[model samples]
Target: MNIHVEYNTEQNRCWVRMDDWRVAFNTAAEAEQFVERLNARLNAPHSWGMLSDWSPRPGAKARANLRCAKEA
Candidate 1:
């Protein structure tokens, strides 16, 4: 569940790296929150890999809906 956060100013993008390449949020604040939550998961020991992407507001919303397919 752990997550890592990184910002790409050149690309004007923010990313959240976790067990899944899920763009948790489009806004930096939102992404940071998601990253914090993901970090909490790191408290538990386990093998983990990064899942990251650069997404804008629209894309983030789409991903959100896709994540919860029923919602879409």
Candidate 2:
């Protein structure tokens, strides 16, 4: 991912930019810290697992599967 920490002279603030999204910070140090943390998180190994075959219990209502439940 393309990311950069930059200072905006017009706004007198620093920001971390990732593509079209920009997160502003009051100081350059804050922006740099944010970038460092973001990089760390991105580089860390992910333990997320894929979903297995799953279903609601027998005799259960639609609400038992929250995804199948309609908004009230």
Candidate 3:
């Protein structure tokens, strides 16, 4: 995702554009803080929950099917 911080002249405030979402902050400091937190989250490792350890039962057919689905 792309993030940009800029001042909104009409609103007299700092605004952060994260992809298609726009958020306004009363001060540039607040906007920068928000961006820092967002960057930290973006850089953090991801968790896949239950799927993290999941795998199809060992079989040629199952592996073939998985590959076909992924290609599609």
The numbered model that scores best in lDDT is 3
Model 2 agreement with the true structure over 1-72: per-residue lDDT tens digits: 889988999999998889888888898888888888888877887655512433335445644646521131
Estimate the TM-score of every prediction.
0.42, 0.63, 0.62
What does candidate 1's lDDT look like per residue over 1-72, in tens digits? 446777878777788876577574556997876666556665656543432343345565566555451232
lDDT against the true structure, each candidate: 0.61, 0.74, 0.79
lDDT score, candidate 2, position 65: 47
Q: Clash pairs of candidate 3?
A: none
Q: Which 10-residue window of candidate 3 scores lowest in summed lDDT?
A: 63-72
How good is model 1 by TM-score?
0.42
Report residue 67 deviation for candidate 3 (angstroms): 38
What is candidate 3's lDDT per residue for 1-72, written digit by digit as tens? 999999988878998999988888899998998899889977888778845765647577556546431133
* Candidates ranked, most accurate by TM-score first: 2, 3, 1
> Which parts of model 2 have CA positions greater than 4 angstroms off?
48-72
